[model samples]
Target chain A: MELAIGIILGCCALGAGICMGIGAIGPGIGEGNAVSKACEAIGRQPESKSAVTSTMIMGCAISETTGIYSLVVAILLIFVAPGLMVNILKEAINLL
Target chain B: MNRNKRLFKLVDILYISMIILPIMIAMVIKILTTPLSQGISISGARIFFSIPFPVQDLIITEAQLNSAFVLISILGVCLFLTHGINSGNLTTRHHIAEWIVEKVQGLVDGNMGEFFKGYAPFVTAILGLSGFSSLLSLCGLFPPTSDINIVAGWAILVFILITYYKLKGGFLNYLKGFTEPIFVMAPLNVLGEIATPVSMAFRHYGNVLSGMVIAVLISSALQGLSSMVLSWLPGFLGEIPFLQIGIPAVLSVYFDVFSGCMQAYIFAMLTMLNISGAFPQEEYEMRKKKKLLKIKNK
Candidate 1:
């Protein structure tokens, strides 16, 4: 039972790590591309720096939502999951 | 003059660093005033007159004040800039501010006018309701927004607006709006008009309250796990002033500056779209032409 619990936790840990990794990719690339595009636009039109800055802020907000979701999942995995607690409680009851 | 220039640059940096500006203010406030430091750890749910609506919480925690003060201060600056310090006269700063305002105004002019106008009544009502959400949260009262009832109210509002507009648009014209030679969709267009606002409200409330829940759960879970783990690591040090006042600051930044602002803007946007789509202006023009046609048919 302990070994099964360990495996379940190990899987959750791996799943969370994978989630963070996959989730970061899309936002990272999208944000980087957005910055580069903004920089290029600003370079071409220095006067429009305000326009570029606002666009960058807006795009970054849209891209960052997925990263927030990943963090939520990671938090759920590490702190809130009850699988291990349930198993241990069952063990104590059986012993009793 | 250069000394004046250097002073301006410093102030500019202070203002631009949005997270720290508030932290510095909060720290000064913390030092000057003794904080109650005591949170009632309210259930975030309460009954009033046998109705299970979440009683608005008047939570006066440092976290809540930090958020509210920073938020209100920023609102003043953004909406009424001259109301505060003239800001650092950092050489080009005035121009930059004016330019920023212009661009944002341009964007608003491009999209928001038609959006806001047609949906004025609904938008006004939601704003009045949710503005109260902020007030209730500030005063240690349970916020109704946390309850499903408040959200259901918004959902019903959207449904009614959509139906009212569609029905008033007349059966044929409204059906035509749904099914035009109009693109690659007929039923999808009809479905989308409905799905948009309701989904928007749910996504927003779900996201906002979910953040609060996560923050609460984090502290609770840590209380449970603190015994097992390296107690040093959850390093709420971010919440501490020394190690990184800025780190914990980012959470509120996300919660308020990002989520709260986005949710407000989206609520306004959805309200506009839902209400406006119902009474599309073209319908009036169409009515005029139909009247002329009827006379000719006569």
Candidate 2:
């Protein structure tokens, strides 16, 4: 029982860490690419600076949604999944 | 002149006291109620009370209370800005109000075109409420936006508006829009449509909640570190979380201020974009033309 509980907790922690660490890379790269392109656009045509900037910000925010979704999942895994699994394991052990 | 000056001073004092007294009372109550043994703990919005019903009991949370306060304060600010408006001899408040209205109108016009000019107030209200609600965390209150239900409600409203505009073409047309280009894409389109509100709600809630979680973690870490490092100091001095003094403020500046305002702006922008994009432009133009012809005939 103790080993099972420990395994559940360790797996949850590992999963959450992996989830956030891997999840952040895509948005980071995507936002960097967007900002760089926006910078290039502004440099080429300074007249449309405000328009490009707002569009870039909006695009970046929308792209970040995927990263935020991963974060929510990771948070749930860390804070909620462990206790829930432990409780279920305990109940199963008692029934056995 | 002396009497008038004294009266003005009295009025100022009264105004200041009206603002400060409630805050002071609340602070005292909080200080008294918080247990000393806990040291510091971070959690979800505290439930103040619950009302019994036939089904589930309705619970009032700190988020609802803070959001209500934010709304009332926004109302007060609007009233103050719009008070005694006129064409001539405009006050600074009047100018501020005009500037805000113009900016919101320009944003709606630029993004959604002139057809959505009337939605400036709705956009402004969302921006104000979301921004203000998130910023309430700066004052050590539970930010309502950190609550999923609040943001979900807002996102669902925006989704409803989008759907309403889409249905304006015709319910049959709206249903047919799902199977555009190919029949197999219907499920994908429907999934995408449902994902809109879910993504919006989760995006805003997760950002704010993540910032708050980081803040709490950092503060608690600082507390632990301070006690560990400063354990050799005198009584109570060592117990004080000296390391927590200015670091959390810097984090709050980004998380509470910048992120809060940015999320609010993004939410409002997405709402405008989604709603306006759902509208059929050719139909709108046709309606406008028909109206013009009817007026000419009359």
Candidate 3:
């Protein structure tokens, strides 16, 4: 019983770490691509810097939502899920 | 640049304080007096002798209470500033107001076609509220937008509008939209449709909430770090949030100014696209043809 609870908590930790780390990669690359293009545009036309920068930031933000979604899941897994796990285990042990 | 611009800027700063001051007072009141469990209780009037005769203190969550305060304050300022617009000459404030109106109108017209140009006001209001609420966090107010319920409320409004427009286009067509390409994909189609507002609300709420969380955590960490560093010096002097000032201000530029404005713009943009997309394709074509004809005539 102790081993089972320990394993579940360990799995939760692992899942959360993997979720956050992997989830970040897509948004990081997307933001990088957006910023790079924005920089290139500004270099070509400095007058349009405000427009380009604003649009780029908006684009990057939208892209970042996927990462945010992952973070939310990871947060739930790490923080909220443990409580659920303990409750469920309590029920199971009660039945036993 | 000009004297008028500088004076207007000063007035803008003053107006901002006018808005923040009342909200700050409300917040301080909440912080000092609000109970731990039921934070900032406001008594609601007995309704229809509702099940339980005398209702106890209607507990408003700290976040909700603060956001309500922020919203009311914003509404007051909006009303005050916009009140003189109809009567006044094109003063600096008027120019600034007109400039915003023109920009929002242009965005609506350009993105959603001239047919939906009337949506400019709605779009502008949402964008303004979202941006302002997010920025309000800088003033130490719990930004209303950081509340999921607030964004969700806006999203639900947008969802209803989208559905209404879709139904207006054709009820049968709207029904058919749920089963596009194949009947088996109907659930997915419906889900995708529903996901629009859910995603929109969550995206904005998550972004703002994360920023708030990060700011709080960083400040707390800074307090700890400062205390640890100054351990030899002793006492409360070491516990001062010395690292909190300059660093958090720099971080706030990106989190508050950039992300807040960007989210607002994105929300407005998505709202426009979703609404416009609901319109029949014929309207778009007709608008295009009219534009071409006008250009040719010119």
Which segments of candidate 2 are over 4 A away from where they belong? B1-33, B284-298
Better model by DockQ: candidate 2 vs candidate 3: 2
TM-score, every prediction? 0.49, 0.89, 0.78
Model 1 Cα lDDT, one tens digit per residue, A1-96:
667667767877888789878978887998999999999999999999997986686666556666656755764675556466657767886999
By TM-score, the best candidate is 2
Tens digit of lDDT per residue, candidate 2, span B176-254? 9999999999999999999999999999999999999999999999989999999999998889889999999999999
lDDT (Cα, tens digit) per residue for candidate 3, span B1-298: 4997677667666767767776778667646664568622222211212233456654455455655666666666665466457754656756766788889988999899867979988998888788877887777666778767788999999999988877764567778878889999998998898898998998998788777767766767776787777777767776666776699788888888888888899999989989988887664466668889999999
Residues B234-269, candidate 1: write the lDDT tens digits: 656333324222443456456544665565555655
Q: By DockQ, who's the top model here? A: 2
lDDT of 1 at A68: 52
| Residue pair clashes in candidate 2 | none
DockQ for every model comes to: 0.08, 0.88, 0.49
Query: In candidate 3, how many clashes are counted?
Result: 0
In angstroms, how far off is B159's CA in candidate 1? 4.5
Number of the top candidate by lDDT?
2
Candidate 3: lDDT of B60?
A: 51
